[model samples]
Target chain A: MKLSIENLNSFYGSVQVLRELTLHVNTGEVLCLLGRNGAGKTTILKSIMGLVEHNGSIMLGDCEISGLGAHEIPRKGIGYVPQGRRLFAELTVKENLQIGMLIKGEDSHSLDRIFKLFPVLKERLKQESGTLSGGEQQMLAMARALCLQPGVLLLDEPTEGLMPSMIASIRDVVLKLREQGVGILLVEQRIDAVLPVANRVAFIENGYVKAEMERDELANEPDLMRHYVGI
Target chain B: MDFGPFLFLATLEGLVQAAVLCLIALGLSLVFGVMRVVNVAHGEFYMLGAVLAWWITGWFAGNPAIGFVAAIIIGPLLVGVIAYFVERLILRKVEYDPEATIVATIGILYIVQQLVLITFGPDARPVDTPFYFLIEFPWFGYSGYKLLVICAAIMLLLAVWYVITRTRLGLVMRATQYDRETAQNFGIAVNQVYAIVFATGAGLAAVAAVLIVPIQQAHYLMGRDPLLLSFIVVIIGGLGSIRGTLVAALIIGLSDGIISVFFSPTLAKMVSTLLVAMVLVFKPEGLFGSRSQL
Candidate 1:
């Protein structure tokens, strides 16, 4: 399945945050969205997931999912983690995961999969999710998105503000999702951390993709990397 | 004079009143704990419960004993079913908006109260206590029926505690209260939980009304006093805390009991209100509240 976003634009009341952005991710591929803060990266992801009102064409495979509500979007083969790990804080880790599965309308072995990848969650399954470290919460957030077993998974800043080791763990989790043959559209502020795992990268500026690159060829484009990523 | 006997009577009466207060207010607190709506018309559900009990007893007037018990149990069940559908049809649709909920539920309260008056007539109906033997106990002269109400209320509290602390449904309810979106993400059917919680709350209010009606006769205005007192208890106890609600109920109940024993019932109510006002001013978290946030 390919998650294709074309001419996508979103607004916060009168102010337009996302403007005519286009990007796509094929099955079993991780497509990273790169942009500085306030560059409309999160807006694009939120719009696609129907958390914000937007004008655009969002196609999951051949199906147009732009008009669907946030809750309905997951049922149509797209899962969203949302920003800030918008988890139920008072609930236990297991309950948080269970809520994601409940929405899927399918009974998958999500519990086994979550524990298999993040064994720490298994030990802390009964503990309140809010008490978990930010990295653990992020892992549960990602695991919750995956529990839906979507054909297309859209994540916004899955590894933001984490310790170096925790960031690497999340990056590893993204790679593992790719290995499981899932299509991923990852929005990130840290370009370098995601580019290595991402098969393709798009640099978004002013709600538009200013540049797109294949990860393997990015090494030779020193000027493009320096200008776009500011690294 | 004889302070021991008066104090003993007040203690017994206060405990019984507290038990009923806790039962009804717990439901109010539970609904507030999750939905954040005051459910202004919650009192009307209690009214409906008493009216249903009266209606059922009238239906089975052959043997007053059988009629009374059946009416008490069935009253709340009937009201619970009605409340379930009412929530789905009306409250659930507008649960997100608090202002809208207040207006709508207040509207529902008037509609329900008027309906009861029309059906049962304007006069307050007398519900006979099923048990006639005035169980005479040392230090307190009380009817066995009143003791029965207190015991049933305590048992209900225990059952509620078990359901909340020992069951999966209880966890979901608590989780839903603290954060709704998260509960939905975890695959918990939030709407189902809301319906069940709302019905249980309604049933509880219904039971509370029927239990106390024998001591304090049933009237169209029955919902008023309980509603006012329970709100005070819930406020002083802290919203959404069961332990807090129970504690607050006892405090208000005992104060009212003692005041009415020595002073007037009106004075007791005034004193209780004054106490609640002080709590809200100083320790808004209540006697046993864990946190300020809901």
Candidate 2:
């Protein structure tokens, strides 16, 4: 994790969001962001990744990447799994990954590593990205991001609308990412799926962090869950 | 010997005109392919090419062969250099703004035209044909210079085809056009490609002008007809398809030639327009334009 966002305030065309929000994650930590719809949970991850316009300070160690462009952010070792999986529809899976590697400026080791982590992607490497099933497409998107060899990984709604089994698989992947000492910020509507894996939790409400807790403190606090997250 | 035979000879004359027309269109197609900008001043570049050729060739007033050789070699490269500056300074920034880009090009066109008129005068100048001899075939006879232009044009076209298909530069151009951002992410420098493509296109137009200078009188205003013909060729040929442009050029050349022989010039024009309409209705993408391109 080794990541921190302090007193972060964001806006979309004068509309305020994430009012003075603050959250932190340590190394090898899976921090889940829990909220209902319009919770600005995805916005948090997007803002951190510099995908959206925002006024916030996002720090990965000594490096502060706020108000940077998406392309510039990735090179700073931050990977984003944007909502809707935004895969290049026309490009083949391999081509999509190659484009990532290309953007990251050619590392043969990263390419070989991603292919190894997602073996199914390596098998169907030449297939068009749009043809992949939901689970496979998710794997491809994650793999594309992983090719950047990011120190900080931002997963936006990774398990949204997936079958239970698929959700469990993604959950397992997130846990494995945590084990590998990757700083992960997970945005998910499926609270139960992420609760078991997250080291700490942040509840976002009305564009700010309403509550923050360690896994033990969060699991014990029933009133906070029902009041802030609607249980 | 026979007055009636003038009709047959005029037909071959028209093919010469078509050859020059194809060159103009081919250049237009090239510029449009990489830059995605329709250069209104393109005809002016062709005219400049012809004028420069005329000037350069006139340098060796007595030595016609040397002059002819000089026009082909020096005319294009010189215009290409001028075009390189115009692209870098003028058209480069306004590329995405097509309408504004056209106005800017037209501005350059007027400046160049007036400059030529001021320097060369309003009178149309007769450019000397390197070889004044006539070459007669079984069916018709033509000025040796006109035949040479036809031959040279075909060679230029072939060279252009080879460059576009066989070169590494061409691959990057095609890839960039399809998806610019994606291409850039793949380590392709798009700006360099755009400039080079623009220069190549302008160079091609200059070559066409050099070849045709001898057959027609070279004047400041001589570029309009070539401009019109180039537009027609691009329309009939699919946009950005080099093969389609060449095929369309030959078809237009042959048809215009045959028509001028058998009918009046007005009727030939009417036939060409009608054919374009038919093609538009039946195959709107020209000959080879893809669905996405259209």
Candidate 3:
């Protein structure tokens, strides 16, 4: 299944954030959205998930999901790991995962898969999610999303503020999910992190898609990174 | 009267007061916790419960028990239905904005109060106790119905606790309470949850009122004390904290009851108001609430 957005225009109040932006992530591919701050990378993902006011179309497989309620959008097999890992802080880790399972009407089998992916969650299952370390919290957030068994996963800044080891683990999870045929739409600050997992990169500027390149094209054109991302 | 028996009487009165207040405050806390909106009309719902109980019980002229049982079952249901419509029509229109909801609920409060006043009249009508039994204490006899109220409140609280902690519906509610947007991300219909929660909150208040109407009277203005006391309890317990509401209710209710019997009702209110000020200044998170922003 493919996730596609065409001529998307999103606004916050009267101020427009995404102006005629278009992007797509193919099945079994990791498409990284690269941009400077305020370039509307996060807004695109939010618009896809119906979390923002947007014009134009978001199609998941054959279904048009542009105007669906935010809650309804997720049940359409599009899992979203929002920025800042908005885990239910007071709920226990087990309860957090239970919510994910309950969302998709999945049984404990999905939980077993998640446990295989991140064993640390099982150990701290009884602990409150708020008390988890940053890495653990991030993992729990991803695990919660993955419980949906979504075909298209929207991950915003998954490895932000994480230790190098934790970042590597997150990168591996992304790669694993990609291998499982989940279309991953990722936004990350680390170019090095993107290089390993991203099959294609789209440069966004001023709420528009400025350029697009394959992974090899990005590896060769190092100056493109400095120009678009200011790194 | 001996001091021991006097004290015992005060304690019993306090327990009954606390039982009723706990149910009322828990509803307020639940509304605040789930929706983050202050429901000023909560007290009116309580008043409606009492009035409805009186109205429903009037049908069973021969047996007060049948009438009382019918009142208990029908009163809260009617209140819940009314509340559900109120939420869907009014609160949802405002998008649950904090300030707008306050004003809206205030409107609802007056509308409900006036409707009752117009129809039920302004009389302080009394509902008969379902059963006329007394528990024989060593010193004196106590009303068994009052003790039954305490037990009913406990059972209801436990049922609420189980639903919140052990059921999927409770998980969804807690998840929505924790983070609204994320709950949306995981396919939880937050708006629908809000409507259900608002109704449930009102229903809880109604249940409390129905339970207490026999002890007190079904007066349109009776919501005033319970509302103020519930506010004080909610604030002292911590906004949106169930355990906090329970603990605060006990503290305030017992103190008010004991003080009222010994001193004056005015002193009890004053003491509780002063305690609210102290709690706000010293521990705004409440005695049982986590140190999080209210």
Candidate 4:
């Protein structure tokens, strides 16, 4: 399946955040959105997830999901790991995962699969999610999203404020998801961290996609990377 | 009467008051906890339940047992339906804004009270107990119905606790309470959850009224005391803490019952209100509420 956002414009109140941002991600691929703060990178993801009010078309394969509600978007095969790892702080890790399955109308069979993906979650299943470290919280967030078994995953700054070791583990997890044929739209500030895992990269600036390139082209054009993304 | 018999009676009376207070305050806490909306109309729902109970029992004037049974089942359901519509039509329009909902529910309280006054009349009415078997103590004989009310309240509270802790519906509510936006991102229909929570809260209050209406006569004005007391319970316990609400209700109920039995009911209320003021002044997060994460 392919996730496509075309001519998307987003606004908070009257203030515009994203302007005609166009991007797409195919299954078995990682598309990294790199931009500075206030460049509307997160807004693009929020727009796709229907978290923010936006104009223009967002298509998950053949389904036009632009105007769908936030809750409806996830049921349409779009999983979201929002910024700050917004886990239900008071809920046990297992209960949190159960909520994901409950929403998807799926059974708890996928729970073992999620546990296998993030083994730490298994050990902490009964512990309140708020007690987990920052990295563990991110893992729980991702695992919660994966419980939906979505074809497309939208991750907003999953690696922010994480230690280097945690960042590496998250990168490995992203690559592993790619291998499983899940499309990932990752928004990140660290180009070096995501460049290794991303199949394609889109540089967003001033609420627009300024440049798009394949990993090979990015590897070959060092100066282009610096000019577009300031990496 | 000797002090031993008097103390025993006071203790039993306190237990009964705690039982009723727990049910009413639990409902108030659940609504405030999940939706962060102070439902000022909650007491009105309680009043509606008692009023409905009287009307339904009056239908079967000869058979008090059947009437009480039917009213117990019907009263809460009717109040729940009303609450569901209020949430959808009025609260939803205001986006469940905290201040806005307070005003909206206050309006609803007055509207409900006046409507009941018009339809059910301004006179107080009573419903007969389903069963009448007095338990004779060595010192004094007590009404079996009041004891039944205590047991019934405990069972209802336990059922509520079980549903909240052991069911998927409970998990959804807790998740929504933790973070509504995140719950929505996970494909949970937050608005639907809010509606259900609102109705359930109102329904619990209605159930409390159904249980107590046999002892206390139902009137348009009776809602005021329970509403004030439930607020005191919720405030003293913590805005959203269920465990706290229960404990606080027990303390408030028992103290009110004993003090009212010894001194005056008004004195009990004054002391409780003073306690609330002290809690607010000293520990604003409440006795059981954690320090605000903010």
Q: Quick one: ranking by TM-score, best first?
A: 3, 4, 1, 2
Runs off by more than 4 Å, candidate 3: B291-294
lDDT of 4 by residue, B80-121 (tens): 999999999999999999999999999999999999999989
Best candidate (score: DockQ): 3
lDDT of each: 0.81, 0.77, 0.92, 0.89
Q: Which pairs of residues collide in candidate 3?
A: none
Residues A106-155, model 2: lDDT tens digits: 57787787766677888888797879988888888888788777777888
Provide C-alpha RMSD values for all models, in order: 3.2, 6.0, 1.2, 1.7
Off by over 4 Å in 2: A1-231, B1-20, B58-70, B125-137, B140-168, B181-192, B279-284, B291-294
Whole-model alpha-carbon lDDT for candidate 3: 0.92
Q: What DockQ, on C-alphas, does every prediction get?
A: 0.34, 0.16, 0.76, 0.69
Model 4: per-residue lDDT, tens digit, A113-222? 78778999999989989899999999999999999899999999999899999999999999999999999999988887888999999888889898898987877877
For candidate 4, give the lDDT. Answer: 0.89
Runs in model 1 deviating more than 4 A are: A6-22, A54-78, A100-110, A149-151, A205-211, A217-231, B89-95, B187-192, B290-294
> What's the i-RMS of each model?
3.7, 5.0, 1.7, 2.1
Task: Report, for all candidates in order, the number of backbone clashes.
Answer: 9, 3, 0, 0
TM-score of the candidate numbered 4? Answer: 0.97
Q: Per-residue lDDT tens digits of candidate 1, residues B117-161?
A: 877777788877776677665765677877788899889988988
Query: Which model is ahead, 1 or 3, in terms of DockQ?
Result: 3
Q: Which regions of candidate 4 fall more than 4 Å away from where they truly are?
A: A105-109, A219-224, B291-294
Model 3 has a clash total of: 0
